[model samples]
Target: MRWSAAALAAGQILVGGPVAAAPTVVIIALLAVVGLGVAVADRRLNTAVAWRQVSAVLMAVDLLATLGLVLAGLLQGNDELWVLLVLVVLAAALRYRIRGALAVALGAGLANGLLELLVNGGEPGPVIVGRLLVLLVVGGFAGSIARELDVERRLYQRMAEASQDIVAKRDEDAILGALARHVKDALDGSRATVHRYTLAGWEEVQLPDVLSVGSADGGPPLLTDEEGGVSATLHRLTWQQGSGRQPNRLTLPIRLPERPAEYVVAVEVTGPRPSALAEGALLALAESSAVSLATRDLIRHQEASNRRLERLEALRTRFVATVAHDLRSPLTTVKGVARILRGRREQVAPEQVDAMLASVERQANRLNRLADDLLDAARLDSDALELKLTDVAIDDILRSVVDDAGDEVELLGTPGLVVEADGPRLERVVWNLVTNALKYGRPPVHLCAETDGDQLTISVRDHGRGLGPEQVENLFQDFAGSGDPDSVGLGLAIVWELVEAHGGRVEYRPADPGADFVISIPRERTPGGSDR
Candidate 1:
């Protein structure tokens, strides 16, 4: 009912005589009438059909209103009436469907030309016709351009929606498959496949293939010939009528670090040539996918490493338990024999007693050293070695180690050398080095100490056969030895561990005739000390 009233009002005003009312009032009346009709019709029609019909009717109404106003002004001898016609035409072209609106504009233009002839009392001239033609052309062109813009906008919206769907999928295979399908649709390709290359080779995956299979067989060549290079190549191929072969093919290589060539992707397509924009977008997608594949591979490798480390830890626990159990029996026997020998020392025969006591002492010392090394290694592995730090003279510690070993070490120029260290551990380090020199060095082992600024240096020189470069490289490594049948190979390893704990470093150099092992530690300030 309201629409009927509005339409009647608009029709009455359009047919009414000329007056001084504003031109805008006429435009608003026409728009209200057209908009009301459209709203009513839309309730009974499908949305697309309703929009088209309403747009057509509104454009016609706008054209008739423009003609009526133009005719009224011409009849009244108004010269500025063409401006009203232009506004109506532009508004109609902008607001309505292109095809029907352009048709209405043509009809209105013809009516206006005829009205002009009638008002001027003759047929219209070429000047009037040309003016009408220009208006029609401008309006039609604007409408067509707007329609084309609308079509492009809709297409972009659809592509965006499809891309969003692909990105939201959790499964990689599904995502890749969707991406390939989107590419095929966008490029109008007959078929599209994504191939990944790894160190082993390349593999073809279905649109959604996510199982990570490798391509080792003579599959089609990679897009780029250069090793580890990523690029895209397009080729045109012959296709038989019913052979289901694609006529145009495109291959793209996806590269990521530390991944096999098979994991990289080569997108294959067969159809008409793809545009540069389409190809660029496809390459971008492939590169992103390659990064994701590389990330997944790294995660897998780290998980494997963690599992291996757990297994190694278990084995180490078992080995330590076994070693501890084996050493207990020997320790018990040595302790028992030592006690017996000590209690009957006066009553025992000299030769028999001497031999028995020597055997007991040797075995006891061996057991003690083995136990100490095992504990120390365990502490190091667990990162549980704590240091009791103190300032001690390096020369004093060396002298004490030599005294404990009961070996004569030839002293070179003595230097007052003090170092910040744990006394017991430092003593152990010096003793191990001196003992190693005594055991392996030719007679007359040399012990020397010197200090320079913040560093204290100590060296044990031996005249034994020198170690080779390879042996020296691994000399301080645990369980590494001089290849001697009688040596257990733990002395230098222990020396290294203890010296490192005291913030010192050790090096072995082949002396002129034998070997020289040197240790350097940070020197501490000595209080009330004289050169010794």
Candidate 2:
């Protein structure tokens, strides 16, 4: 429009004659120069504020320049300069829609006709009337086309923005949130919400008002279908609340392949409802959002898989190093003790020989425990460790595991406390706890248990330095634990897996003097295989 307006004026200037007023020619040339300069200088005018300002300025310039040329009598023999008025009208329409264009058209036509008549000494001729009619008609037609084009432009721009937002979000919640915000803005609504139908109820992006599904108000439900499978539909809602606002609703059901109409986007506004262009945009947004959300899910799943693989690789490397060091230390001790015993049987006294043998036995026991933990871990990894779900006394498991820790370990719990579990697996869980307490803890390690309703609570507490916050956090992770010399790091991991298999959880309970490891197993749940 800017170039066209400038070209029409330049054509008048080039058709040289006295009728082509030199001042008029200079003004048109100046308008073109200024238009070209603005176009070149304001390259970053992508925002609404900048574009609107530029359009207003250009429209004003075109109208004033056209009037100046007509007043100067430069266009007396030619009405070609009138084409510049059409461009001015179109520019007004682009800036402020059809009303703006019609305004410019009427104002320019009357101003030009009045000026021409005054210049020609009050002649009400056919030429002036015809020009006014041409101006009004051209302005009205151009305004209509501009309005339609503007609507289509806005729709495309909004859709593209929504699509970009969807693709940029990395998670489902973010995608849904982005979709809701963009949908609301696109539809020019007060509130917009995305709802996903679930078995429990309808879950929405924004917490719905009291009018959500299943409320006692018994107002019109959000979902039209009784089975919660409605397709795309729009409805008008009457609210009992609000002071002066009349709220309307636009519901669009987004259906994915092989899925029912489970996800819906609802937009509510106070004033006017969305136009057909906005409705079309909403539908396109829904369809594109579904595909983009699915693609986002696939991307997230792949990222999670990659993270798991990286973790497994790290665990394998750490496990190999830790197992080798634990096993080698114990075996080397046993070997050194045996060599000493073989060489000094005659020189050593019976008491001294017995002490040496006990040292060898302790190292051998350490090696055996390491081997057992490794085997249990491998069984857990292979999903081959089945549980023997039977009625077992929880108190018995606690006392037995504590007693196996020797005299220093104390048992404190209720009697005849029973639960349904794999006795051996439950015993290994207790055994690992006791082993951990004995190895890293002070004397008087306490094992306690209690049955409360349907849950069995067992705790093995250590009165030593216990563990730091960091150690406590990773206490139950593979190859991760407190930096105790005797810890192979698999004891608590195995204990956690076994307890979880029995439908229980183990946690590091904060104790005043030390740290407490508590395992809570539900007695009502049937035992299952371990998960490490």
Candidate 3:
């Protein structure tokens, strides 16, 4: 705008015969030189205030140049130079849309009319009015087109920046939040929110209903009930709660991998409807956001797999250390006790010989338990473990396991309780729980059995402090679940697998200042021989 307006007057003065109007031509030449210099030297103003000031100065330069050319044309009796008035109107229009253009048009018309009226006063009023009308139309039409072009350019630029922000995050929540904020700001909206759609809708899932779906037959399907768009809502654009005025809804359908239902983001506004450019910018942002969401899923999955691998490696290292120490220590004790009995049978007292034998028996039992755990774990891994379900007295199993744990244990059994379960496998489950409590916990272990509706539950609790939350999380994994030196690395894992085979689940309970483990199975669920 600045250079072109200036150059036109400068070019005409140089090429055309312009010596007739000396002062007016000099003014035109000076304005041309100044406008060209300013255009070349200027930088883009950063603030709104600076832009407005620069805009005013440039508009002033254009207006003066146009006026100078008009006056020069009049003084020289040349009709062609005044045609530059349209450039003045267009410059204003590009700077400040429609109204600015109209104002400049009025100024151009006045200059032409007044110049003609003074220079040739007998010129008809009708011709002057017609010239003014034509100038006004030119200003309006040109301004409108330029304004539309600037709007489109700004919209696309903002969308590109917004897309970058929305996808920069590597997590799901952050991506959703960025997309909502960009949409809200783009539409000049009051609020925006993410809406997720399932068979059950809205607040139950912690979002506002922006759109609702009912079966065309008025059934309950949400996503499939769509005419062309998904059923969901967010912000004030609620479909179910119609108030005094209807709010507009813009839904972005985001499909997360492996999720059962459709995910949606919605935008709402209490203001005027968004312009076409804003809507286009918004849709482009949504497309970018969907791709970012998929990327987030991939990134998170990769991170989880990495953590799992690290955990497995750590557990493997720990399991190796435990097996060496635990198996080797017991074997050494058994060998030493046997050597003592054989080497000094006569020298050792009868009581000393009996004590040595008892010591050997205890070490043998320790080695047997460790071997049993490894064997059970291997059977579980290969899915070769079987359950032989039969009617068994729950009280008897509880009593037997508690007795095996010695005098430090107590049984609080419901005497009449019975369950259809694999009697030996159920006993093994109880034995492992009792032994785990004793190894990792204090004395006075409590064993109890109770009927819970159609299920039977056995609970073993110890007086020692409970396990930490982190320990509880990996409590069923091979090698990772053991916290004690002699959890044997596979004791609890075997318990979990054996219980699961009986259609049961093992759970950890947080007793006050103690650790409690519970095993529960449906008493009526009798599947046998590994077939079911």
Best by TM-score: 3
lDDT of 3 by residue, 1-532 (tens): 4455456556556645645346446656757665664565465556778766766776776677677666666666666556677777877787788888898889888878888877666574787678778779988998899887887788788889989997898766677777766666666655555656545664222322222211123222222222444446432122222236535555555543333324566555555655666665666677777778778778889999999899778777777887888778878978888787778778998987777776667667666666767777777778776666789988887776664567889988688888888786678778878877887888789998988888888889999988988989988777765556444357778788888777788999999878999889888874342422
Task: Supply candidate 2's per-residue lDDT for 504.
Answer: 89
Give each model a TM-score: 0.41, 0.57, 0.66
Best by lDDT: 2
The CA lDDT of each predicted structure is: 0.61, 0.70, 0.69
lDDT of 1 at 228: 43
lDDT (Cα, tens digit) per residue for candidate 1, span 15-113:
554452344356557767877777777676668876777766766786665665565566566534554555555666666646644655566567777
- Specify the poorest-scoring 10-residue window by lDDT in model 2: 234-243
Runs in model 2 lying further than 4 Å from the true structure: 1-100, 107-134, 147-186, 205-247, 252-264, 270-325, 348-362, 386-434, 441-488, 495-532
User: TM-score of the candidate numbered 3?
Assistant: 0.66
Displacement of the residue 479 alpha carbon in candidate 1, Å: 22
Q: List CA RMSD, all candidates.
A: 16.0, 8.5, 7.5
| Superposition error at 26 for model 1 (Å) | 2.4
Clashes of each: 17, 0, 5
lDDT of 1 at 323: 58
